[model samples]
Target: MAHNQFELLKQRRFLPYFVVQLLGAFNDNVFRQAIIGLLGYMAIDADDKALYTQLAPAIFILPYFLFSATAGQIAEKLEKARLIRITTAMEIAIMTIAAAGFVTQNMIVLLVALFLTGVQSTLFGPVKYSILPSVLKPEELTGGNGLVEMGTSISILIGMIAGGLIFALAGAQGPWVAGIAVIALAVAGNLTSRAIPPVGAGAPELRIQWNPIPESVRIWRLTRKQLAVRNGVLGVSWFWFVGTVLTSNLPVYAESYLGGSPTLYVFALAVFSVGVGIGSLLCEKLSARTVEIGLVPLGAFGISAFVFDLHFAQPVASMAQGLTVGGFLAQPGSARVVIDLAGIGLFAGVFVVPLFALIQSRTPKGELARVIAGMNIQNALFIVLAAGVGIGAQSLLGWTIPQLFLALAIANTLVALWIFTIVPEFFMRFLSWVLVRALYRLRVRGIEQHVPDEGPALIVCNHVSYMDALILAASIPRPVRFVMYYRIFNIPVMRWIFRTAKAIPIAGAKEDPELLRRAFEEIDAALADGQVVGVFPEGALTRDGAIAPFKNGVERILERRPVPVVPMALRGMWASMWSRRDSRLGRMRVPRRFRAHVEVVADAPVSGEQATAAALEAKVRALRGDAA
Candidate 1:
């Protein structure tokens, strides 16, 4: 397990795959921008150039709609590394045709090659994301995804810059340079693909579907099979929509508002791209290398905040035109505009990475590739829709670019709220994550080594405070269905969070026998369905700072389910504000320790048959040591 995301960049398992995908993204952008550059060299009028500019994106996106389902099936049926090599090899051939088009200066040939490039990209899309879970541990998913997003952001920015410069620098020889450059990049990507070690296919025994329309529909349905996975896919597509709108507007926004030439447009884009790279890299540290969907809400609102400020940052169009980048920077309010762009990109990175990680982690291995393919198809639709919406808002509604941005900020906020409402887990996790981090500097030991990544397990811990469940959930990589006391489960505002988390609430037999029976039933069902169920064997928050006597409820549950039992301990939580110590004193609780050091330790699993309540309690006590 790599503690640092950068470490994966030095290892063969991740580095080769990362490089191959990075080069492929770079090549795609290079080829597209080079075609744009080629227009200046051709004997075409402004109308024709605009038409080509408009047509190129539609041509490039067509294959994602038409072939994604089939591509997804291919990715699942074929070996992963072999599929990557095949896609890269196909890229080499496609770029060869593109080179020919460039050399001949044929618009028709170039369009055909661009369509082919889209086809190649559609084929590679499924495997590009699905391969991550196979190679990286669950704990490393956030970091791995962060690195990939960072690579992609930098590559696209650099590739566009490189490709755009070809015609500017080479002039008469621009066509030759563009042709050779794309081909060389294609070859490099292929060579890197060859170094990716063999990774087994997700669904080797799966049959391929030849009919694309029905297959695409089936894959789309697959993406919706799980609530979290479905919403995650939606979130990913929404990211694309937001990105398309933001990036597409930048050129005009830079020219009309900032009073800058094409160079300044690039400079604006570069700032945004750098922000994305920084934010993506920050996900690992912010998330503690876990798939923390809490960041999603934070990212969502952050995007709206920055974008909303962007409208106010430059509400009026500039009177000046064709100003240089330096000149634009020298103007008042220019710094604020730049900051807004960068902030939007930064939050966008924070918003999208976790959703990708969530979709990958939660979806079944067999369906992941196809689900990603489905996501690509939806993403294409969203991109096209975003372009149309932006155009319609400006043209039909007679709105300025700043007004369109203002609408975008409001729309983004509404959409995020809608998604969070439909799936409160994202919001719930955010709350828990915020609360836990604000209160404690958490350290963990033996969790990655002892806690099972997959399948059913019983987690028994010593409960010290009302926040034990949230703290444990934050500490552990996987979701744990905690069996907390009903009183704690129903605590005013905290009740919503608990219920959203699907925490099982139980009462004592004397208080409510039926409720106790139902709780036991829910726990058994959860465990039977191959989920982690957490229990504090003490059955209540400790009145004193000492561990309480173990109850027999855990033993009863184990006899029914008989799953592997993990003993965990929480240290230094007893003195926290949420603990019984303050409440027991009948005094108003005040903040005694802010950001206190807390440790969550887990011991090796004990077999269900061997894990008596007493035994598990003893293990937890030993794990806690003298810290409590």
Candidate 2:
């Protein structure tokens, strides 16, 4: 598939939908904050302010229960771009009314705005996800969805912080300013919405769902009908469940436990967001354009371990002290202690990105929109569960914030163990650790232990340097065939060695179609004959010594063979003799003794369902023991 990467970000396609979705999030937070701020200033004779605040998220989630069933169906059948325009326009009107309510200090009106924003989001739900499959290829879906997820999360954080600031800076009249900002955003969103590439209706003339509740139930039932649908939804819902737990409780922890100010709030969020963003991008860098579900379980472990440590780490600094604005930094080892939060976010990137791609790639064409709708319902329910846990821990058990962190960590571990045990691919991979403790030997982890001994497999590794393939071929007991770039196949000195190893040659799709054709035919034959084939998915040695996006040649091969994909991570090669690690590629070369420690760790054969480059890359990153 051609990379329309720049075009994907252009105003006509992805930008419109991004703007619509982002502005909607912005408006929702703005109106909610306006209500909360107003409630703070005017002491109404209501039952309890805390009570109302606690219930706010629940009220917002209610619409998912009420409208998502039909909304997804509507999204599948309606013109997506037009639907976005409608939603944006609705936000403008709804926010206008919210502003009026704020002016009159009407609590009831403000609450209505919360519910209305939920409704608007509900309507946009199906359209947002369904459109991606239309615009992207299998490989592009992971990066595309990753960008969207990261962007959406950042938008939410920005909206929340900005909404509060808008109010703080302006006072009672602050909400009016918020409303104006939202309205302008809403208009810009609608304009962009109109420009999106046309995505046709999936189920044209499908019956309009008059009853949202029963219909919603019907779709939830549909999700449970298939193993793929059920497991995929469960995996996706876990992200929300994990997210809701952290976001809901942190503020209270910052206030009462840390005795922290708003600055601390900003710091905590920034750390988590940056960590997750880094993790998500690493997926692309490491996976080399494969869906690396192996990272999902890896993230699960990190989430639990770090969160557990955070639990133990917290009470020490927090025992007698309240966190001040300065305390965010002042606490001893505060940065490391926050690893749990960052790990949680980073794992979130690992966990969620592939699932989104999986859903897009796997969902039935005509039902893709409805499938996303099903996702929204489950996601909402899981978030509600997260809030419930936070509330129950806080109010019923009188649990402290750090204790809640401990509980969440334990729960995450158990859940991961259960999931992996049920699907041995993840567990089996973990069990395959080969601890050859020889100082001269390469000690491999994760992959070598997990790769199936039987069947034809394609091994993909990031091309960090020229020696990457040679090192992997030498270590793994099984003989492997390598697909190499034509340039390296003819290197003056390395050419004979390449021929002796029987490496395949590849050219650009247009550069040498005949060569590509022969390569494809050979790959297909190798898989059919149950041979193990290895390829430099990164296409060439990393010039800067970083991972590169995978070439489509591998994807095209998969479309033909659909064989078990064995993702391998070759570590220590960057420093090895045949590889380049610095600007001085050949100048300050090290001796062969320094290269003796290089290792190749091959992970399990990723399933066709989860064999995406992003998924595979995450697994390899862990194996490489790099920045991840």
Candidate 3:
């Protein structure tokens, strides 16, 4: 019930888990970068350094592909907090081995430790995300996810910076420092893990799946069971692909194009990571504390826009070479390039957070960890594919880095369009969200307290304008299957939005009995399947800015399905442009007020048996008060 996302950071339920994940991510990056730093400390040749660098990522990622399915099963079967502690404890042991490798300056031992670190990470992956829904409410999902993403971005950036500096600052003592640093971080993460209060296992009765390959395939199939969740998983994988491509090229992009040294490369990465953290924090404010997938399309196109600009921002190679970070920043067009990098990361954060929340919210809790496991497997593939694609485009095709970026921008747009096309829900929500926010400053009361969170419920509201359903859709947290008059449902461009939203369209019995019967059937089915079905009990828009008589549709729906009835009212909408107030001439007119203040209020639910149409209407009228 924390209203602010930052509030959760102060609470025991979220704080310890947050710190644990942050330290873990920090440790992972630190260990990885320390390995890179060790090359310099040991004075390894450039060729050997390249070989080690090439081998390291593959070694690190191998466990995700090999053991993620088994990891998912283990996460499900074992209690979540205990599982987390075990992973952290394992991290302690793994980092101990990594420390030994660092002290001994043994590449073979380091690689083995790196692979073990990947195994530990793979084991932690499912629970990292799957634990959020258990600890946070549905409304908190977006904010909680945003915070986690922000923490991760910042931790990775800082860890890389900290680890990279060890050799540079400490000289001959770099190895010992790196060794102690990673071990200390591991210990810190473990200590924080101990504070994460007990979270029950998702599927305590689940049998462990020993074979990773077949189990991976099975879990992958499980992810596809729900259309939204399936696409969400795909979106997350695509994010990894995009991130891999973009981040992988930064070093060369920085050194070659920007004409800067390694410091500038880290600077570029730092800006991008900061942008992601900022955008992740912004999700809560933009989404109004709801799991608003509408942001996904916005994030998608924003990424393409900034990345496309990035190509033009630095289309040609720099005339100057070996510039420092400050020198690079002093050059013309440098600000634009920095902004583009930051913008891409910002949108990337926006794009991925909602999808994670969506997947967590929609997937069955019992299967969530495994589904995340499936997602991780796919993400690994995408990351590999991204590396290959980036390499192929530059090495084989002989494309410049800017040209590669141009291709990425175009590819990102196409992929986003394809995903939105397959699942119009993402696009539909985007459009509705845009329209609602543009037209009204919406305020809500009693919804979070009164509206049923999990089970089926019928929402009866007083209809005031044509935009009622869309407004209500934006205001309500859950997707409501709104039953609207067929005419409004079929309104030219709006028809597509309505249909994609799965809004039930009905006609009067006299107009079309078959359609009416079908609409009723759909409503009943939706309610029976445990969905929120919204209907304006007035059955038509009010003409005189007054509530109309309640229609019997509400009574009929209740008599059939008998779900909990929530009475809602939309105030300040009657005078809006979409209303019937000035429609006597049957011609459109400019709105009297742009960005009007609107209030959507709901009263406590009435039992289905007790909710007569008249009683529901009275409740809505009372909720509306004298606002109309």
TM-score of each: 0.97, 0.69, 0.97
> Between which residue pairs do clashes occur in model 1?
none
lDDT of 2 at 34: 57
Model 3 scores what on Cα lDDT?
0.91
Of 1 and 2, which scores higher on TM-score? 1
Q: Which stretches of candidate 3 lie over 4 Å from their true place?
A: 315-317, 584-591
lDDT of 1 by residue, 1-628 (tens): 7878999998999999999999999999999999999998886999999999999999999999999999999999899999999999999899999999999999899999999999999999999999999999888899999999999999999999998989999999998899999999999989998899999999999999899999999999999999999999999999999898989999999898888898989999999999998889888888876789999999999999999999888622266899888888787888898899899999999999999999999999999999999999999999999999999999999999889899999999999999999999999999998998888888888888889989999999998988899889987888889999999999998999999999999999999999999999999999999999999889888988899999999999999989999999999887676887768566534455556678999999999988897788889999999998
**309-367 per-residue lDDT for model 3 (tens digits):** 98888623376788888788788889899899999999999999999999998998999
Of 1 and 3, which scores higher on lDDT? 1
lDDT of 2 by residue, 109-161 (tens): 77787788788888888888888877665445666677677777777777777
Question: By summed lDDT, which 10 consecutive residues of candidate 2 come out lowest?
Answer: 430-439
Comparing 2 with 3 on lDDT, the higher-scoring candidate is 3
Between prediction 1 and prediction 2, the one with superior lDDT is: 1
Candidate 2 Cα RMSD (Å): 12.3
Clashes of each: 0, 20, 0
